[model samples]
Target chain A: MKTVQNNTIRNGIKVALWEIRKLVWNKAFIISLLLTPVIWGLFMGLPRLFEKIGEPAAAPTTYIYIVDEIGIYESLSQKVSDIDNLFLRKHSGPIDDLRNRIEGDENAGYVHITEEIFETRLISVMTGTGDTHIPLAFNTRLKETLTRYELAMHNVEAGDIEKIVAGYFVSVSPVIEESVDPMDRVRKWVPPIFAMIIFFMVFMSGMTTMQSAISDKRDKMIEILLSSVSASSLMYGKIIGNFFAGLIQLAVYLIYALMFIHFLGIPGLGHIPVHQLLSYIISPELPLLLFFALAGYLLFSSIYAGLGATMEDVMNAGNFQGIIMLLPALSALFISPVIGNPEGIIAQIGSYIPFTASIVMILRITLIDLALIEIVIPVVILLASTMFMAKLAGKIFRTGMLMYGKEADPKEMWKWLRQ
Target chain B: METLLNIRNISKQFGKNTVVDQVSFDVHKGEILGVLGPNGAGKTTVIRSIMDIIRPDSGEIRFNFQDNNNFLSQIGYLPEERGLYRDSRVTDILLYLAQLKEYPRDRARKRVLEYLAKFDLENAGKMKIKELSRGMAQKVQFIGAILHEPAILILDEPFSGLDPVSQDVFSEEIRNLARNGVAVLFSSHQMNLVENLCDRIFMIHKGKKVLYDTLLRIKQDFGSFKCEIMSEENIRDKFINFKETEKIEQEGLRTTIYLKKGVEPGQFIQKLPDNISIEEVTIKRDSLHDIFVRTVTEN
Candidate 1:
């Protein structure tokens, strides 16, 4: 048994080297090796560049054409004046003629206000086109406008409402008493980067694993391979091999990230703090995040290898694969929403699901505090799922390797799984 | 001959359809055994069973597995479909395969180089599998199979795509391997090659064993001998007139006389005309192709 295990591991290493050679030695990956880090460095370095130049108050590019025919324009200006990224311009003409104004600048749209119950509540954003596909960010401006109108209606001084939107007060202990930590504000952005990178690496690498197995079958190399090594060995070799390959790519990206955060001194991107970015990188929870990412990746990749083996043809990749394929994207989608309610029921549910657990748990860890059990539970579940998937993939890959030339029978595939 | 590998009563069924039924054969050291069967006749299934690629539903395929050397590495397999990495260099793929078998790198590389040279694929060692011509690729794939010099070699349709010259090379190498105490179990659609290369032949029809015997014994027991005579005289009537003559055909000056199964060739040839101007008289045993056709169609 020990010898068998040793053989499997040895063969697996060979398999991994084989796969890595195919992937990393390719021209496209070679090009990406050099290009990806530069792109990543510049991307992560942009905020730092902006902070050094210090644009205290830049003029807004998008101006709103505000029309108040009921003689409330001056009063509205005093209360809900020039919102961030949206400056207000008073319009004298009727709202019907605003289409000509919109035709001149698509970004410039007129907001017409009418007196409703004397609250100045009724407003219409008039763009020339019938389908006014306004950006969702405009809703925040509209909500702020309504809030100021309500405050003005109550005759509270406009000067007292400098901070209109919902804001949180963060406390720092030593540096400045009662001052908000800038790190606390940007912490939400940190978790998603981990989640996105994890999800992207896992999902993309998992798909490549499937494509690779299928290519082996197509090339008729699986038979020689099977005769040479056990199916489990082959599976381990492929999974672990490609996993290391993903790590290499990640390592390249990390180097770029380090260079961007620590070295690339772009003055335009001076707003972001390097120390905050470094904190996230060197955070105590980082290891756990990486563990979940790997576990999730294995779970998905095993399923992919199994699917590739059984499907025979790409067209035959059915619902099981479709569901597995959607999982990473779904996990990534959970990232943004979980940032808001990290301790909510949806997040807790996501943390338990092996598919979404990697991103969800990391997001939860980033935003909220949890006991030891919360982290352990999802990781344990993910590890179990990974083993199960690996087993299923082994059986299916073994059976399907020799299935050659015929349409893969779904019934036979089920039998293999059951066996 | 000692049976190096014994397949006893092995049967396989895919769904309700039986693919291999009660199939049995043996491969002995220093012997070349041919497994001849028509298309869809259980040949590949039986070979795969021996390789343990698929488990047989019934019966045991026992190899003389040794602890000192990996038995799997001691067996070289050249599948009919001929699988190799199309994009990989021959040396790299060969090295990886040998490594999987636990072969030492230097020795495996040395053996691979030796075989590549022997098979006239020296330059192809650097080429990708897809870059090689079909014959060259087949040679490279064959070298890959034997680089470790396995004790037992199972080659399925090894000569299917080879030209005559390369076929001769394979035939020579197969005999050379058998002489060097390696067991070879060969399967091919080419009957004459099977007859020329194999010492013993096992035949199947519709997943059932129909004939299993030495090539000489198969000719002696299952078929009649034919006498070919070159004569100006009409020897056809003389042979047809004889009671022992089962089949008689006259073509130009040559006449072929097949004796009845129960009657020996000596019984009919003695009664032929002495004054028939016979120039040459040679007896021909049934070819493997003829026997194969007869057994399959009849069974």
Candidate 2:
């Protein structure tokens, strides 16, 4: 037989192709890939759907039966004449009988104006449907009429009563000094949002990478494969394969989101200039952000791949291994705090820590215009830590994959790492 | 004989426990070397070291070949802890494994079909591993190991989980591979099969080598004749004083006497006491199984 020797890089690529085929060709993964965006679209569109369903077909005239003990019924009836769908009617019967008459009718309501309302300041409007909200215009007119009558009872002049009940109002209007581009809003938030996208992508992809390692050990295929290739090659293959898989998943989700926004005519996203947004993505900062994202993925995935080898099964993973698996999620916990205070101490410290650096740096860059050094120092730190983690994980993986039947304790892993 | 792989004074330890201590053996082309040991006897550890799945602490494992970096691709390994990806098709898993050895895809596919037919699993290439029975899966794993036509084949307990008929098929194929100049390191608890199949035996106990010689020499050195005498009464005390008897086992009416090495059965029977109720007398040389059991217990 001719001797066939594959190089390390080629072997790693082969391993990666195997992992990619295993994940991408599976039915369950494909189903989940197509279903996720559909589910997200449903969640986003359900409220708008309900609002369209709940809107009234046409405005029906509402009969407001007033039991006025204060005897201002004729004036009140005349005051409500201009409202097209609302009419006031005087009622002399008992308040209980009037309430029973309008109990089940949504268009019918009763107003009980007792003398006690002047002291308590509570106006009770009982409608047939329990959830029928009184119109704000109607509520304001009733309050104005009641205040005018109450002021007249106190011997105030009719013309002065208008001045007494007419309280002050404030209006807010933005003064535009210059034209605002609609894409400006999209530009400001896209970087941090993209950072979060990277974080989520890493989280999902890291899990598959870890599970792949565990599956290799569980299936007893590690030794056989390792005989043909090195352990480092296998680790690299898993990380690279899952990386592309995650990107494919993210692309699919983004496509569905854009399609939903376009077809459904979601208001805010409709008028944004697509070309300008694309230009913003292609800016120089994108490569920097991508570097952070790639470094972060490498950092956490290596740890996960290493720790997975120490586990006999996912269900029986040790506490230490389980915690390492969740290391990517640590960046998620800092999202709220860092977004709230981009220049604060928490964000600054998070940008220097390897685990949280990628996400926090992305948040800081997007939320605020940062200095060049602010990005550079964190990038260097993240780059160094990523390299360190990959090396450590290689050591741990080489020995841990051979262990079986029981999980490797931290001490045992430490020994392997040391070696 | 041309030595394809050589292990020189290899030792491996786990924590403070020495699992393989100063073990040395050579796998020659066209020879089947049987690795015999009880459980925890370091046979798997040595095989793994040779395969480069694990490293020895203080010894050298050298593949005596031209290419060192790609030596592993030329060695096929079937580990004792054997399994395949359960959710994957048999053909895909085998192809992937063969490709790792740098086997061409077209040749791998052709070889996969050939092996499948040879193992009577012609219709199982499209099926997932979980769908196959235990014996079928074993056959698939065996095919995966040899699909690349490796120069050296390291099989750790290859006959495990196989029926007698399947075992015979595997045995014949292994012999064929050896006859085609493949060095086979076969480890198994089935001593009878090993005695029939292997050209040489390397026996170990408690992580140490106890016997390393040709099969004929091993038999001559340790395989003594055993005498079985059936009587009406217990004959346990009758052979206690006989110098020719190395060990005695009495079970109710039957007494088995293991004679000292090189002592003929006829020479020892002449000294048998007369008037003993000897209903039947039979003499036979010890099989490899008995020799293995005796060597393990003696140490």
Candidate 3:
């Protein structure tokens, strides 16, 4: 029988293809790919849909027994009928008849009006308290109608009140940002979303990479795999596979988000210029960002891979994985502080730390227009750390993947790392 | 009898505990080498080192062929701790494993079907591993190891978790592979199968090599000038005066006695009590199983 040998790069690619096959072939993953967009559409599109649908239908009509001895509610009745979400019908009947009608089902409630002989006044509106929702709407509108009538009696104008509430009369307006950059509003809101997207990409892809390593270890396939190629080649293959899988998820989510903005005209998303965001993405700054993102994924995932190789099962892997999860969690923690003070000392320090660089650097760039040198510092650090992690993972995981039977203690792992 | 694979004083240490001591052995083309050890005897460690899954601390493992890299594709290793994707189809899993070994995708796919057919698992190609019975999974895993038609096979506890019938099938296939000139080195705690299947044997205890020789030579080196005694009475007290009694294992009505060097089997019968009712007397040569026990115990 003839033996075949593939170059290291080709073997790594094959391993990557194998890793990717599991994800693409999985029913749950495919279903999630389709379901996520639908969810995003629903979340983002629902409000705009309501706005397009316009005013809602009016509420159910109520027959009011207007005991108008003093004739105060005549104008109130006209205004209540005009209200879009309410309807009113006046009843001109005796007090006994009004009470009976309210006791019966023909009327929702009744308004009784009477003036004391000494010039004091008394008014009462009665409705069944069995249901609150319908009654609350009915009561609020009826009360508002009476309030307008009282205001009219006192010579207060409704148009003037609206003008006052709209801040037209207020001389001062609050402003947050100093610069008058037209894209300031867009930049302000979009960065948190961008930072969160980076965190999600790094965390999820790192998990996939870790799980792949743990899987081979669990299946004893690494032993078989090592027979054909080096452990480093196998690791590179998995890392490459996970990178592509992450890219696919990112693309799908981005496309759905753009569609959410483009078609649904979601409020904040609609204001963002599509061409501008696209241009920024493809700009020269993109390669550096891409480098940071790739390196961050490798840095975190290699740590995960090393830990997972030493673990016996998914549960054990999760324990170490939870510790590794602190990278994104800590990045998320740093985000609020970094965004708050984009150019502050905390942000400056966080932007250079490899684990937090992917998140904090993106936040710093978008929140504040960082200098070119400042941006390059984090990118270079991330690049260097990524190379270091790749080497360390090769050193640690190769031996960890092969050791069996007993739990992987720290001392043994240290020895493996040293070796 | 050309040397197909060679190991030279290989050793591996995990932490401070040396799992595989300075061990050495050779596998010949068309030969079967049985690695025998009790539990935690570093059998799997030695096998893994030979496959280059784990690097040795102080020695080199070399194949007879010129291209050591090329020789890698010619090895089929079934680890002692074995599994396949429980949720994946049999065909996909096999194809993936073969492809990782540098087998051509199309050829691997086609060959796997033929292999499945040979194992009477044609219908199982579409089935997930979880759906297969224990024995069926064993057969499938065995097929995975040999699917690439590797020239050298290293199987660690290959008979484990198999039904008797599957074990028999594995034995036959292993012999068939050897006859077709595939060198086989398999480790097993099941001595009978190893005795019946392997041409030569390598035994280790506590990470140290105790014995390594041909099956006949191992038996010759540790002869059985021993007798099996069946009696209702305890035989330990009877052998107290017999200076030739090397070791005595007494359980219920059976007493197996191993005699020291130069002791005769007939001499054991003469030492027995005349008043006791003895049911049987059998004298025999040492088995590979016996040699394994003696080697481990004596060392």
Candidate 4:
């Protein structure tokens, strides 16, 4: 009996080796691996490239039509002559007509400095259609010129006027104590982020497992293969093969991510406490994250493999098959809610549901530290669910692999499961 | 000859349809057993049952070997639906198949090269399956089946789409394998090929075994002498009156007469009426194709 089991395992590994060889040596697979870094580089570099390309060649000049009722235009223009892209033109026409004429002109606008500035100490700048607000350079120059003129009229000293116009120095300091340490925040965030990575990796790898089964059926190699090895072996081999393949792909992405973080100096990443974060991630909590991720992957991938077998063609998949394939996506819906309040009712329920437990538990762990029992219950549930799913998937795979020409209906699958 | 494989009282049903019913057969070493059946006659189902791809409702498939470990490794199957990974190279796919049978990788590699060379596919090894012609692909698939040099070979419609020359090549290879002690179970619609190659024949119709016997014995039982005559005169009645004439068919200027078993052509010719004017005459035994159609239609 042990020998038979050994043979089965050996055969499964042989099948796995074949699958790995096919995927690793495939030209498309290799190209996609290489393309990940190139795509990441493009994603990171495209905006900066566009920014450089978008820099203004030569700023368009704006003509400031000065409607001066007070004799301050000459001095203001002289004071602002150093500013590029700004030209002041004294207008002798009716102010209302000038304003009306330049209303729609993007490059021209008028500023009226009347004696009302002395009474109300207010001056208004009417902009044209092109300008949404008064230009900062022109406004600063006008303020400086008016203050000096007013100081001269009032017999105030130039030093006092300069001090009055000078910008004030103000500093803000928080009075409350720091709530969360930056290191603690990084340490808290690493597990959930790692969980998210594992979840996506499992999703990608599970898809490949499905594709592997579909291709075996589509290419009509399933029977020949089954004659050499059992159908469960074939299904398990695909899951195991794609699992490693997905890890290799994830490793490639990680290398690119590490390069980006190390070189690009992402905000907060540079100031993050790496040693503390690494220690936290390498602890027993890491095993919990891995346990859920692995169990979740096995559960979904087995079902995906069976779903692929029942399909006649990937292009025209049945509605039942499509629904089964979307089973993993249900786990994603619990992400935000569980993260919102880790101790809330939703998180508690989600952590117990087999489909959503892996992700929800990971998110919950990051938000709030849980007791030992909190982790143990979900782990047990996931392990049991995974084992049961694997067995059921084996039955479906055995029958469905031989079912040619048309997709297998749910009723037929139910019959097979019962058998 | 030793019976390397025995299947007894096998039955299979699929939801109100009996695909195979009470089927039993034995495949002996160093011989070819041709499984003859029409469309949807459950030939594939029986073969799949023997391979353990599906379980028969009631049957025992026993392989008489000293040691029964990894019995599947000893069997090689060529399914009716022939396929390989389209994106995989010929050598790679062959090696993978051999490895699946638990054949050593290094030895499988060597066997792959030898088979490729033997099939005239040496130069095409590096090419992907999609790049090969249909015949070439079929040859590659055949080589994949026999790469491990299995003890039992099951080929289902192995020559469905092959050209005549390729068919001859495959036929010769199968004969060579059988001569070297491999038990081969072949299923095909090509009766003439089966008649020429198979030592024994198993015919099934509508999920039941209609006929099963050695080729020579079956011919002796069902295949009697047939006589054809071409004449301008009405000679059908003349041939129909003979005691040895079992049946007669008449066409324009032609007549075919099936003689009863143990009846001699010379005796029948001597018994012909002298008034009949015959332009041409020939006599031969019944062909397997005729017997197949007759048996199926009768059943």
Predictions in order: lDDT: 0.78, 0.87, 0.76, 0.87
Q: List the residue pairs that clash in candidate 4.
A: none
Q: Which is the better candidate, 1 or 4, if ranked by lDDT?
A: 4
lDDT of 3 at A34: 81
Docking class of 2: acceptable
The interface RMSD for candidate 1 is 1.7
Model 3 lDDT tens row, A1-419: 22222466777898888777887788888889889889876877698798878865555555555666556566666645654444455667677776665674533666665544114433456663433123454455555555555556567788864453345454554576367564656545554455457557766887888788777776666777787777877888888888788778888888877765666554544555567666545644445555555677788887777767777676654444457556666777787898789988989889888888887876676666788899778878888988898888788788778776545767676777787
Model 2 lDDT tens row, A1-419: 23222376788899889888988989999999999888877887799899999988767778888998999888888777788788788899988898889899888898899899999999988899976545677888898889988998899998898777877788665786544765677766666566568767977798889899999888888888887888888999999999888888888887775565456643766744445555656666777778888888899889888888888788998888778777767878888998789998989899999999988887787778898899889989998999999999999999889888889999998998777
Name the candidate that leads on TM-score: 4
Listed per model in order, the count of residue pairs whose N, CA or C atoms clash below 3 Å is 13, 0, 0, 0
lDDT of 2 by residue, B262-288 (tens): 899889988889868889999988888
Per-candidate TM equals 0.76, 0.84, 0.77, 0.85
Q: Give me the overall lDDT of model 1.
A: 0.78
User: Each candidate: RMSD to true structure?
Assistant: 9.4, 6.1, 7.0, 5.4
TM-score of chain A of each: 0.64, 0.76, 0.72, 0.76
Decreasing TM-score order of the candidates: 4, 2, 3, 1
TM-score of chain B of each: 0.90, 0.90, 0.87, 0.93
Docking quality level of the chain pair in candidate 4: medium
DockQ of each: 0.48, 0.41, 0.34, 0.67
